[model samples]
Target: MAEKAIAALTEAQASEELARLAHELARADQAYHGDDAPVLSDAEYDRLKRRNAEIEARFPALRRDDSPSDRVGAAPSEGFAKVRHAIRMMSLSNAFSDEELQDFDKGVRRYLGLGADEPLSYTAEPKIDGLSLSLRYENGRLVQAATRGDGAVGENVTANALMIDDIPDRIDGAPDLLEVRGEVYMSHADFEALNLRQAEKSARTFANPRNAAAGSLRQLDPEVTRGRPLKYFAYSWGALSARLADTQMAAIERLSKLGFRTNPLTKVVEDVDAMLRHYAEIEAQRATLGYDIDGVVYKVNAIDLQDRLGFRSTTPRWAIAHKFPAELAWTWLDGIDVQVGRTGALSPVARLRPVTVGGVVVSNATLHNEDYIAGRDAKGEPIRDGKDIRVGDFVQVYRAGDVIPKIADVDLERRPKDAQPFEFPHLCPQCGSDAIREPGDSVRRCSDGLICPAQAVERLKHFVSRAAFDIDGLGAKQVEQFYADGWIAEPADIFTLEERFGSGMQQLKNREGWGEKSAENLFRSIRERRRIPLGRLIFALGIRHVGEQASLLLARTYGTWEAFETAMVDAALMEGPAWDAILAIDGVGRVLAQSLVATMNQDAERAVIDRLVALLEIEEAEAPYVADSPVANKTIVFTGTLERMTRAEAKARAEALGAKVSGSVSSKTDIVVAGPGAGSKEKKARDLGLTVLDEDAWLDLVGR
Candidate 1:
């Protein structure tokens, strides 16, 4: 059996395939973007995404709501606070071949209505393989820093960002408010040195410079980030108060003048051929650049042209990334092992014989799920010609953008005679809990919640993780040791460590690895975190589907621990006004709301919450508001078309000014901005006696 061709697939078949693709891509996005770990090779992910796109193109109405085409990245990780980007950060479409690059050029020309004879300039630069960071400067002073998490919201790393010397603290001639977007990366030399230090301490070393740079920047303690050798390269801008320049090249130059490190290899190319040549040059110099780069990015040079081209749901139409080819190597499949995560999801990892992929040693790859090992997709569609992989088989490994390689294809002819099909476990390997898969979810999970030691230990580690309590000198290793010794079993036990262990039969200072000073410091750190913010506490609880953004949103919605707790308890019934209120949140859906309510109602979990609450002072969530803006705290609706800016731009501007932009016109809407072709929403606003203004009047009211 083979995959059905996009052109030959029926509408029902396409819909099912789209659903399958959405689920797989969502998991991949979370692993890569949220966890900073990629599960699938870039090539495999790209191929599936491309297939989904082609299917939707052929059957236009079969697209799913959670389609990969509409998503940029995963939600922000729970380890840090969340930052809502003023302007949504977008991903770029990719081109892997010369033909794709040519097609991209033609597509841009067609979108802008420019003829081939008309000259069009594009800027080409190396695509750095590192974390995307947005640095905001207000009144020449660096104010905030964020990672590109899910495009709309990101992790706040301002404190960690300040430690990087490449980021200037102040600029004398910068705009009143400017947001410079760039990459935060570690050089190869620095990465090697850092790994050597880790190895000396018997700690885990990073697989690549990208992972090291990302992990370092996301450290809970700013001092740890400060100790790492990290650098920044500014390449773009967002939410600028004033225009930096008219062209992309000039804008890069302006950023460089503002004390930002701009890439020296950036060049202006006149046509597709020039773009290709520049990309070739960059690829030729890739190895000697002293940093990692996987591709070259090409963007329309003229600001007006880029604006005219606008954006797709998740990517820009005016720019594309020319990626390097993926690397492949053959190796024997040694074994398959299952690892349990904090949420009790049992994920499988494939152990491979020693092999080198893309200049890195590879010994393991992701098995994804049982369905993947059985040579069928989620929709039961045949893959790899329905060839099931087994131990002792010769497997092809490939690396695209992932730090870990993935099994691409298997050589059936080379399969060992003693090879047998691998059987997935029906019970948790760590605790013997029943392992079950839920409807619509592909991964199998343990039935035992916190009772299992594996889950409990992982949850404890998460509780003390950088984004959570962030206790000094208390890391994953320490948490595991404490758990193994029965010193701490739950979140509440962590607070009682000093009281329970000090002057007891087994004193902490008398422990093999601990001394008086270290014990005292750890106790002091625990004491310092006795007063925790509401958002961090919520995230620390390790509730399913409740990440940093969701936790903050819940905190902001309720403001206090008491209010949040009471609301969750009331919403447990799942059919009242309380439940409706939870659903009313912009980002919270039925699944997330249900998870929060159920966790609150569970007796065991409630006891844990009560114990933690008794020992800690939870701060109320502060309202994120711009006090000086006239539209602050107001609800606004935009209708019809605007000549001055795109709808997304208007929404972003409104959000930046502290106004809430709503899609529907309701009585609660304080203002409505109407333009040409004003529709029923504008009429409804007028009927409701709401303030309705034209686009120009609305712009003037906001002082734009």
Candidate 2:
């Protein structure tokens, strides 16, 4: 076809052509960047690029800024706040072959007016797959933290940043203003643990460490962010008032002095060839590394030279990110199956034909939920197959840049006639209970709770988790064995194990896997856990919706087990407005409140609790300090911010001295700490003829 004829086409025809080109380009980009799999060869991309360029040259006005021909890569997302970077963060151009890399080196030398014989050094470090963040510290304290929104702007996440233990709050001998750029990442171990926890809670599990870090940082509630384990590794600088050392190695050393966590694998190389060698070394050990890294980032060692090279509209001339080729292969989805999680979430798993992707054997991939399988596109046709995934369907499996494998597409034509639509079971596969999907949720949960063996075992494991009891020598397997042997049925049984098993000591010693030393160790471990704090004890109870932090909050509020139990029973019996007030605590949701009441109402569980309480040496509840002592020995409710301390600290301090902290402002509420942002609780307190204290009053009463 003639160029003029193609250029002079009708707008409708031109648009259709552009749409086709866009789709082709997008697919190519997804394959190359997102999936690490290049569907189109480099020669193919070049041909498409040339054709796109010709069309754009012919129809100049029709081209968009986002056009594949003009754009270097994807634009940054807007989920975060925009920051105007003091120094623009630029992406690098890539080289696929050794020849291309050599040519690039030659061009660099030519641009720098240097001879081929002259020696040049470069720093090579792993390009982590994580969310980029800029941390700005002023006068030794962390002042601002932002996400890399665009190369220029980012989202402000100072509050959430405070939760990361690796990111220091203060650095010794730091400049007046320092802006350090780093990657917020999750370690492989932490990621796995988080996924396990998510499965237990029936929550959405993240696909990879990078996604997990990104999702955790973007949570609207800072309190929620506080619970996730995140780490930071300084990689580069955005803006620093103080000058860095002459070499990249020196700059990293300086960053370490400033208390920033720098990646230990960073090394200075003598040339691009050496840099490539470093890349190979890192790539070879990628599987053994604690975090996911997709490539190596190479930058000019000298800041002055970097400034001289300047930058393109999107990328710096001095730096390059050399990415490893993606591991991809076509695999068939042989069947669909469901796995019952600890929380009874029926996870649809695709059983795929064995294939290797990213150096790992990929047999099974998560299919998310049934809704995702059945959802339709704007065209009213199924996005993948006309029908939901069925047995014996030829489905295309994909392992994207993410670690989790997924079913990307299905070939319906190749599906066998005998194939049947997969039916999600209505009963828990592990426990045989009727699976119950909550009103607004898609996950089908087992309502068996502590009664179900699987759930009970999981709960017991959680009770002794690191954040909970942290009992030594009492691991999950031990707990399961003890439970299975009828040695321990309730939480109380654990405290009395040594005494109960003492008489059978000789028999236990003679049994396989039960030596005198092992029995002694178990007893020692149980004894060490006997004096656990109120928070740990409450968490070990495994109340639904009650996490470690929430358990601590309740412990601080009620001070003792007796007080907490009495308050819960009283709140359940309260009427109308009084009942609503009891449920208004920051962590006390309706679901938790209902679960508490239901559990308390169960005679079987209640009897166990009473027996446990009787056997244990219950400590006295701490009294809240009050100058006037008007509400002494009475329950009080606090809402909103307090000038004296955070709500958490205040609650903790209140219970320490002996005051019952109730969630709601009720007729029984003797006093209320009504600080800034006090909500209905304050009003309810007033209506009920209860005394309310402002920030100053609360501080005065607490004698702070």
Candidate 3:
């Protein structure tokens, strides 16, 4: 009786422990993947996962319903519309080691009841480090595109998808409804080019290609998406209305026939050994591939067999992703230096002996922050030489999935005997201003904002950026030339280009690479951009945290340049409900507001603004509708036909008089301005207890 009770208690206790462990593991996974900041190390997370797996195996009869061991990833994001896949595109289970790969292969063979003599064909392809998208075509025309959100419901990105060059507008011999799954990747060359351009323009550089591609695709404006260079390669498929072929190779052939560019490296192998050989070949030549690939993905060639094998909750039993070993190399850490950003964050960068890795010469790598430099190792000793990196110490650098090289380990034995630990400066190297590190942040920042020469040059470049002033023929080199020649110094100086060099224009025409035609083109381009859009003007001002999206939001909200300028100045001078009103703009946060105030208060900035106002024709400020006013403050949801005004003109006029014109209506909507053929927004506004106003009423309220 005692033994039976003990056994029962043990089983119940084991089950409870397993459930608790599973929850913890899932939360950790979410933190790692969703946040990109993992709380646990790889070893610690692996240990916890192994323990949970063991518990689940022991108490099979008492398994929890929501186990981390069972779940693949988080459910689909909520913001996007749901798209149920007819044929689910399952993720692959990963193997970090050759032993693990062998075990995975053995398990697959055993599960399929395959004998030693039985042949198994597999196809291996590169696992791209990019966002997974599913493109659906109906009767040869592209219809929908969705993201791989939780391997299920995905964000509808049809507008952005249309901009991708590789995605065919129409396909030949396609089914009524066919879904082709692929990776939207930014090539390494394009990534480098973009980063160079961003650096020249003093814009925020993306950490990696995957991030750049993802951010570009999520842009609200399809036009903005069209500007980014994005490419795609169809690797798999889902939701087929008509069958293509029996084998995976045949299906790929069919897709190619339908005008899709399938990866040419994909090949049918006779056995697992052949698959491994193909993976090795690919891995060996990965650097020359010109794109970032994290691993090799192998899947069974026969579609019918794959279906029979079925899938687990998140991964298919027939497919596995074998990751390459982290690309690591030893380099001599010669020295360390601090570089200041526009925001004044001082970052420690490791200066190393140049080494070629992934087809690129790497001479410098980010050290992250001081804490990372001084962090302790497994032996409870500081990782860096003498609590920080020394002038001459051998360091191991690693690049995983095209991630920026990071110092992995220090070879103290290889350290030069005379080498000394480097000292960090407390003053800004560029401006000699005192650098200060905030309480929580690891970075030390220069106090000089606009005054720092480096910062000023950077800000000036940002002013004439493509998304800002977009001065044609004024590339980075030209900007540098103008700055060096003392022809232009500030953002406002650009407006006085022709005036400053009116008589000397002939000299510009005679200058090397600047013929009469080029000079005329340059002047014409500058003149053409004088009457700039509100968003472009706002972005050109170089306000901190005000990116292209924020600039558009502020422009749409304010409607006119004067209104925005007045709001910014008012917010800068006063601190109360009026200041709160400025912050109330959808995307304007405290950091942005503070930066704006700081910029406005600077004498140098005020001079630039004054010069700009004098040189350029400033548009008259429009009256924006107020929320409290019966006519002025109403939340108007515009829809239908407007014969008199363009849609843009209508929205601008409505916003000018302090009216909030929303894209969609809610219970808070004051009026629905319907035009000739009022659509869904108009109908929804009426249903949501809001007043419906026609175009005549909208025009009358604006006094048009």
Q: Is candidate 1 or candidate 3 better by TM-score?
A: 1
Using all chains and alpha carbons, the TM-scores for the candidates as numbered come to: 0.73, 0.48, 0.51
Could you give the C-alpha RMSD of every candidate to the true structure, in order shown? 7.0, 19.6, 17.6
**Candidate 3 per-residue C-alpha lDDT over 127-206 given as tens digits, one digit per residue, 9 for 90 to 100:** 88777888999888888898776455566788899999889988888778889998988988998898898899998677
Task: Report how far residue 36 has shifted in candidate 1, in Å.
Answer: 11
Better of 2 and 3 by lDDT: 3
Task: Give a tens-digit lDDT track for model 1, residues 437-507.
Answer: 86645678889988988889988987987557888878889999889989889988889887877733246
| lDDT (Cα atoms) of all candidates against the true structure | 0.83, 0.66, 0.68
Q: For each predicted model, how many residue pairs clash, with residues at least 3 apart or on different chains?
A: 1, 12, 13
The per-residue C-alpha lDDT of model 1 at residue 241 equals 92
Candidate 2 lDDT score at position 313: 39
> lDDT by residue for model 2 over 1-704, one digit each (tens)?
23444555554334334433443454455444333334443333433444565565566544432245433322233344545666665555655456656766776666566689898777888988777788888887898887755355556788899999889988888778888888898999999899899999999887567768888877768888999989999978777777777877788889988788898889998887898899899989888999988778877787776655655435666777676654445677777776654445566767878775543456766565564465332223354545567767676655435434556566778878887767777887778888886543545677786677767676677566544566666767777887787877667787787787683467557767788887777678767666666776766666644544456666766788877787777666644553465465444555455656666667776787777666666554343465665445667688987764556556655654456677766676777988888988888888888889897887677666
lDDT of 1: 0.83
